[model samples]
Structures are given as C-alpha cells and as structure tokens.
Target chain A: MRRSRKKQVIPGFGISMGVTLTLLSLIVLIPMASLVINASSMGFSTFWETVTDKRVLAGYYVSLLCALTAAVVNAVFGVILAWVLVRYDFPFKRFLDGLIELPFALPTAVAGIALTNLYSDKGMLGHFLGQLGIKVAYTRIGIIIAMVFIGIPFVVRTIQPVLEDMDSQYEEAADVLGAGRARIFFRIIFPEIRPALLTGFGLALARALGEYGSVVFIAGNMPFKTEIAPLLIMGKLEQFDYHGANAIALVMLAFAFLILFAINSLQIYYNKFTKQ
Target chain B: MKRKNLITLGIVTTLLAGLLTGCAGKAAEDADGKAAKAIEITNVSYDPTRELYEAYNVEFAKYWKEKTDQEVTVTQSHGGSGKQARSVIEGNEADVVTLALGYDITAIEEAGLIEAGWQSEFGNNSAPYTSTIVFLVRKGNPKQLTDWDDLVAGGVGIITPNPKTSGGARWNYLAAWAYADKAFGHDQDQILEFMKKLYQNVLVLDSGARGATTTFVENGQGDVLLAWENEAYLSMKEYPGEYEIVTPGISILAEPPVAIVDSVVDDRGTREVATAYLEYLYSDVGQRIAGENYYRPSNKTIAEEFKDVFNLELELATIDDELFGGWDKAQAAHFDDGGTFDRIYDGETQE
Candidate 1:
C-alpha cells in the first residue's frame, strides 16, 4: 500500500559524500597512509630493529599506559563532575561549568609549560608538594597530570548531556519502590548511560595517545624514561632521519588504530548487551 | 572513474597535508613591488638563543641601511639547533642559516642546499663563537657533581635533552665521550658504557634545549644539568641565585656555525647581503657581541673578559669535520634519531 519514492534525506547526499570522502582522504587518510608507506621504505629487519629499539619501546609503553590511565581516570572524575553539574545547583554554577572547558581552550604547549611552572619543585604547588617529598614535573607523574588536564573535558562533556537528559523520575520511581540510592544508580541509571560513557572514553583515550604538546614540557624527555613517541619522531626529524621518523610514526599510528578499533568493538558490544 | 577520482583525491590530500603540516616558508619571494627595492633573507637559527641572535640581525640590518639603500628584512626562525637545520633542508627558504652546530650545517650540505665543500667556505667550519660543555648545577652544588664521573655517582639525577635531536646535547654527549676517551681510553664500548651510566643518572630527556633547561631550573628534578656554556650563562643571568654554571677541569669545545644556503641565496639574488651578514660575524664588532653572549670568541682576549666567573680550563673534545666524517655520515650514523642513541636505548631498555 506504500509507494516508495526516493527516501534520500537530501538530493545531494552522493555529491556531498564524494566531496567529504575526497577531503577526508586527503587530510586524514593519505597522510596516515604515508606513515606506513614511508616506513615500508626500509627493509623488514631494519623496521623490526627500530620498532623493538629500547627508547621506542619505552615510548610505546609510556604512551599507552599513560593514555589508558588518563582515560580511565577521566571516566571516573568526568562522570563525577558531570553528575555534580547535573544533580546540584550552586552559586557560580555557570562559572564552574565554564572552568571545565579551560583545558579545551588552553593550548597544550602553554598548558604543559604552565603545569611545569606550577608543579616544578620550585613552583608554588611544587614547593608545597616537595616539602612532602613528592615531585610532579619532569616525572612520569607529570605526564599523567598533563594527560589528565587534556583528557578530562572529553569525558565531562560527553557524559554531561546524558546526565542532563537522564530520566529523574526513574530514580523517584525506584525510591517509591523502596530501592536505596546506590541500587537506583547502579541498576537504573548506569545501564542507560553506558554507551555515552564508552564514547567519551574512546575519544579521551585517542586524544591522550596522540598528545605531544602538553607531555613534552613536563615529561623531561629522558630516553627510556620519559621520552614519548612524538618526541622520538621529532628527534629523528631533527637528525634528518626522515625514514626513521616515519617508521616510528607508523608504529604510533598502528597502535592508535588498534586502540580505537578495540574501543569501537567494546562500544558496539555494550550497546548490544544493553539492547538485549 | 570513481575509483580513479578517489585515488587522485587521496594523492592531492597527501601532498596538501604535507604542505600544511610541514608548512615550508618560501620567504615570500620578493613580489612586493614596493617603493623601495626590498631583499628578504630568511635566517634559520636555533633558539632560546633567539633574543641574542636577533641582536646580530638588527646590527646587520643597520649595516645594510648605512651601506646600501636596499630594504633588508631579516626573518629569524628558531627552535632546537639541529631541528632548524633540518627545516632548512626540507625547504624552509633560508637565504642564510646560523645553527648551533656544524652537524646541522653538514645536514644542509648533504641535502645539496649548499656546495659539497661548504665547510671550507668559512674558517674553523664557520663557527662564529665557541662554547664549552659545562654543568648547570643547582645553587651551591647540592650533589657536588664536579665532572662526568660524578654524574654517575648515584641518587644524582642528571637532565639533558637527547644529543641525537639537539645540537647543544650533541656537545654535551661529545663532552662525555671526550671525557671517557681520555680517562678510560677511548674504546667504543667504553664510550657506550659511560653513556649508559650517564643515562641511568638522567631523570628525563627533554625535546629541546629549553625543555632540558626547564627540567633543571624550573622543574627541580635533576641535580646536575649538562648545558651549553652560552645557555648556562643565560640561565644564570636570567634566574640569578637559582643556578650556577660549573665548568669541569676539562670540557668539550662547542662550536656553533653560520653559512649561506648557496642554492637559495643564488636564486633569491640575496647572495651579497647573505655573504656580508656571515662575514660580519667575525669582525671585532661581531666577536664582541658573541663574547658578551657567552659564546667564547675564537679571539683569546674576548674569552678572558668573561673569564672571572669561568673557572674550568678548556680540555676541548676531538670533534672536527674529519672526526665525524662530515655531517652526512654523522646524520646517517650516530646523531640521527634512530641511529646510535635510539638504538642504544632500544637495546638497553628492552631488557
């Protein structure tokens, strides 16, 4: 009984898609493809050696572990911040909300430099923390702080809308049914927002993985200590070792892809589980 | 047609992305057609020393104003010394380059930016002013690190950038090598051992010279910092009472160089001005400024004027054009990112 006319939302979808595909292919896809292409310029043995090199390996571990930690922490604190914003009303609430975006607007280099100034032993925070025998700047801990500063907003913004749109009546209904606060939150609320949380985690993790500016100032860049993958890439380029630089970049790109793919799979599975 | 278009789009994007990301400065070829004939010379030099080097540019610009009627605008671009050189080679439009090391200039030459025998074009490899490898110690020498051996004496964290990536760090690395070569008899293995121990003492390797300085001066992580004499002097001057430059009994002589990128200058027709700029650096007027900047003049009296605070006698390293077999081989072998430093860390840290 239904006549199916063309259901295209826009008549120019194909043309736009073509343009988009072309633009993305140039800006994102091709340069990324070159990471692998340039790396392939070297022999397999040389590639293996470069990949397995101690400094490069250290960079890998540092990047992944720090990114993972940052994302996980962002998920926790981001949810907390979102929950606070959504669940409560206080004076300067708009100001508080605006402040959460400081990291997003602040240049990572400036952030790194500022964080270094703040947490250095001679810095104000550093002076106090140093009295207690804790060092932040120029340590892996400094890297974590830098990552956290950059990663927090991704999770906060992602979860904030979900929290705001969340059905408050469900909690009120659960209260009416004699369920406690914790039980209502876990059984009723968390399941509804799991997808958004995963989306935030993926974005945060990816952002942290490729972070160079903030990490560089605080990292202290010691080989096999704090030197990161981006820094290693820079080192290669500085020496005019273009092939070497590209090889290491390819490794980073591969790892970034792997992490993103894994996160996407998890997000998909979570959606399926929740649906069922 | 669709597939072919996709492929073409991909290639165009790749080139565009490279251009965007790399962002080569072509010195904006003199298309101004202004009232006064203007010559734009792109000066690619290393930074943190930018403030001091800009003074040189101002002086040179003044000389041109007095000597000729051409409007010369010298654009000074700076970063890590070695990185500046690489940028020039990759097409940054440097009519003249004054980098922090010969290896970087050598990189420019290997890329055919200049003639094959570019080193012979200037005296002492075009090194304008010399500095010695020294330690940027904490105020009052808390850990009492006197020399390279003291750097490995445990619980003493040293901070320096990667030598492979930084010209100043190369001087720091070569200084350590020179020390090991003298004390333990310069075996490659011994050189490796010393560098390994030195690394073990390092808290972190920063990305650039300024980063390393921050690691020591601001961050307060490292007890001892290997820094350029000029950088160390500037740090002491800037931070005042926060840090001091300690020269070891014998230290590596660090020479920072300048050169004309022959290909670029010849094309731009700025060769006369470029030649005048570099040659001016050797004159008494230039040498005095160089000495004031803590870059030890090749002239001995200029070295002594800054000598009241300079306690460490120079036991200079054996780095020359022949020793490193020019910058090409060095770039291919030791100083390149994945070369010895990367390989060493690769081998050492994998365990």
Candidate 2:
C-alpha cells in the first residue's frame, strides 16, 4: 500500500500532515482524553451507577429522542430549502440564502431566547398557536424547535454545495428517457446526493445531541420529561460531582461516536453500491 | 528538503523563544507592579449579586483608597453559585468569593482553597448581607397565593430553578420544606407529599435564579415565581405595577457567605486587599449599597434603616437550625442526586 501511493499536486505533505495532527491533538483529542481519564478514575461500578441512574437515563432519552426528531425534520426541510435556493432565482434570493446561516452565526443562547419568546403562549406566533391549542416553549416540542433551529444551518450548508456541484445532464437524460419528475429525482438525483444528505444528517444529529445552552432555556428542565443529558451533567458539576458528570459525559460521547460510526459505514456502503 | 525542514524548525524555535520571553517579561512587570500603590483582586460571586457588588465595589474601592492611599481594582465574575465555586476550586484565580449558599463555600473549603472555619472570618458568618426565598406573583395576585399551601393547590403554575444546579433554588426548596415541616407537624410522609405537590406545580425549572425570574416575568408562563427576596424586589423595581413581592409567612434565611480564597490571595499576595474588600461589605457604605440593592444588611442598625424596604414580618427559617441541621446536611439529604428532589420526580414519573 505504501509503494502504491501516487504523488500529489500539493507539495509538503509531511508539513501539512504535521500541522493537521498538531491542531487536532491540541483542539480536540487532548481534552477528550482528559474526560476519558477522569471518567475511568471513577471505579467502573460507580460510573455505571451514575450513568444508569433513572433521572440520568431519562435525560439521555429526552436528548436523544429530541435530537433524532430534530435531525429528521432538518433533513427533510433542509433539502427542500437547499433545493429552492440552488435551483431557482427569486427576489431576495441572496438575502434568504444568507439567512440560512444566521443560526450558525447567532449564539445558541440567543436563538434559544428568541425561539422561546416566539413560541411561548404569550408570544406573537405562540398566541396564535395557543388559540389552536398547540404549546411549543417549555416542552419537548420547544427542545426540538431549538434543535431544529440550530441544526438547519448544518444540513442546508452541507447539502447546498453538493446540489450545486451536481451536473444537470443526468436529470436531462433521465427526463428524455421517459422518466417522470419524481422518478428522475428519486432514481437519479437522490442517489447522487444521498452521501451528502447522510453527512448533513450526521452533523445535525451530533450537534443536537450535545446542544445545551439553547435547549435548556426552552426545555423547561423537568426531570423525567424535558431534562436533557447536558443539563444533567451541569447539575452534577454544580453538586461538585465531577466523577458523575464525566461518567454521564463519557456515555454521551460514546453514543455520539457510535452513531457517527454507523452513519459513516452506511455512507461507505452506499458509495460502494452506487459505484457498482 | 532536509535543509528546508531544518530552516523551518529553526524559525519555529525562534518564534517560540520570543513568545516565551515576551510572557516572562510581562510576568516581571506584574511582579514589579505588585509592590506599587496599585492592586487588583477578583471577586467571584453568584448571579443575583451582580448589582449588589457593582454598587459595593465602587464604594469599597473609594474606602480602600482613603484608608491605604492605594488604587484598588476589583474584578467581578458572576454565574451560578455552585459553578462559580467549582471554577474557584479548578483555579479561576478568585481572590475572594461571595456566593449564594454556604454549601458552595464549604465545597471550596473542602478543596483547600479557603480555610476550614472561613465562615466566622468576618461578621454575620462572613455573610455581610442576607436574603430569603419569597414569592413573586403578578401585579394583582390573581391566584390568591398567600402562602406555601396555596402553591400546592391544584392548577397553580409555579416557577423555580432546579435545586441541584441552583443554590438559591435549594434555599427555596428548604423554605418550602420548612413550611411543610411546620404545617405537617414534622410528619415525614406528609411533608414529602406536600413537597411533591409543590414540585408538581412547577411549570419551568430553570437552571438559575435569574432564569427562573425570566421564566416568570418575561415568558409569562408561571403564575408565581420562587425568587430570592432581592431578586423579587429588583424585578418589582424594574417593572413597576407589573409584579408584586409576596413574602410568604415562613421562608428560609438565605445567608450567602463571603470568604477570602486563601490559596489564591496568598499566591497573588493580595490577601490584605481581599480581606479588606470583604470586610468592607459590613461597613456603613457597604451596608447602604446592600440595602439599596435590596439585600438585607447584616448590620442591625442598617437593617433597621431598611425595615420599610424589606419584609421583616415573615418568620425566616435558619439553615443552621434543627430543621435542616446545616447547609451540608441539607444538601446531602435534599438536593443531592437520588435525594428528596430526585425522589420526588422519580415517584411522579413512576406514577
């Protein structure tokens, strides 16, 4: 494998690899390693008890369920929004496109506050929704809304470039071959963008899973209900239970890693199947 | 290629050396300044005391200057009480801490940053000012929520922070528990049931006192807010005719203590200033600032001066009393993981 390597256009591969490794180690790996080290110092039984506590488990359930729902929602609407932005031109197109990135730019806490205000029973939209007997803020629904607001940018940004880069000839050829619009999209267009969509889905899911600041405001933070895992960690830290907090965090990190791994493998399998 | 790598390595080493020397030079300058007529100390405090300290710091600085002829700069860091204490334990360089609860200071004491008996370092258990848990209801009190029993009555929406994360909320919980203890005549089962109902009425358990106030005042979700006395007064002052402070007949005396972080002050050689800074909190101007900021002054005379401003009629339960024993015992029995608070929700979830 080493001998089969081809030369790259970009030189100084060694330097670039060194820089990347150094930055990654400094920024990510070291802190994560410390978390692992701290969690491991707590005996396995205590760590198990901390993570498997009823309230902790409930927090994990709420966080994972809300994040998954939010990711699915983002995947669907993010695609539609990205499709509209990339395929069509309209008034304020640039403005609308710029707005997609607003969630990414705005602090998550600000988004949480703004979304809470917009969805609380007395809020502008919330009042109308209240008339319809729909409640958003301070519930699981509020958590999902905050997650979707923050995760939408990840999905839209990821899929937009993929959609832009795809050639129109494939669609044209499929259309000419007597395929309907739906068939062309599902059979031809979708296969090409599935990898990007999965990536976006993974990113959004991962982001939402760890989101704390935004969701806490809207979560109402009731145990066995709206309490999220990150808030549980915060609670543990406040109690000076660093070991318990690290244990919970370690479990969350492990779950997030597993989900990312599963998505990555699925993407690889899809890429291979499409190539064949 | 080897020569180029060598050149790059040499340049990097030179830059690193230059950066290290720059930092060393700054350290030297700081060391020199430590002997000069200027000093700085950091006061790490809890959330609601932001205004209290903002007013107190300026007065303390003037007093310090007048006394010692030295210009003192006091940096303030505010956040959740326990979080602030944890930061101090993890080395945030806080010369002194004025947090929301005694347990937070106890945690720091356990961490060996402050002395074991730091509570008695100054007057009033090192708590120059005190507050209590009170109810902040809407202007007209439409719920007719007069006391603790009204909270547990059906259909009354309540808002308070999570006790596990908020020191003030712990006091709120203890206050409610104290009321239950008295009302139920110390019947454990009845008290637990009463506490359960009170928690069940809570619509939003925000992570901090300020957030709970926001949930009550800004979001307009809950019918009443379990708030710090100072916080309730501040909200009333901020939005007149929109909210009213309802001092419950029974509440917990929330004595937020202050202590010099021995390790940090000793290391930074600011022990004198840090000690004086906290000491000044009991002074006349300091007491006045505390009163103006709605915190009950620890000084009897100062407290008397603000008797009209504060509610002195309510019976305030002390954490150090037999009810809860102390902050440490109260924390372990009530707010700790799988303690009463957790069990309350656990029972609810099971049902």
Tell me the spans in candidate 2 whose CA falls farther than 4 Å from its real position: A1-10, B1-35, B347-351
Q: Candidate 1 on A69-150: residue-level lDDT in tens?
A: 8899989999899999888999999999999999999999999999999988889998899899998887788888999999
Fnat values, one per model, are 0.64, 0.53
Interface RMSD of 1: 6.1
lDDT of 2 by residue, B258-313 (tens): 99999998887999999889888888988999999999998989899999988877
The alpha-carbon lDDT assigned to residue B14 of candidate 2 equals 66
The collision pairs in model 1 are A26-B13, A53-B346, A54-B346, A220-B205, A221-B205, A222-B204, A222-B205
Pairs that collide in candidate 2 are none
The sequence of per-residue lDDT tens digits that candidate 1 reaches over residues B1-351 is 355446656666677668876654432433545424777788888885686677877888888888997778888898877767777887998998887777778778888888876666777667867777789887899888887888888798888887766778777876776687678865778877777788777777777788888777766667888988888988899989988777786677777777899999888788999998888888777777887787777666766776775653667764653545544565556666455555556654533
TM-score versus the correct structure, for each prediction? 0.89, 0.95
Against the reference, the lDDT scores of all candidates come to 0.79, 0.90
DockQ of predictions, in order shown: 0.46, 0.48
Give the distance in Å from residue B273's predicted Cα in candidate 1 to where it truly belongs: 1.1
Residue A129, candidate 1: how far off, in angstroms?
4.1
lDDT of 2 by residue, A18-130 (tens): 55555576679999999999998999999999999988898899999999999999999999999999999999999999999998899998888888888999898888999
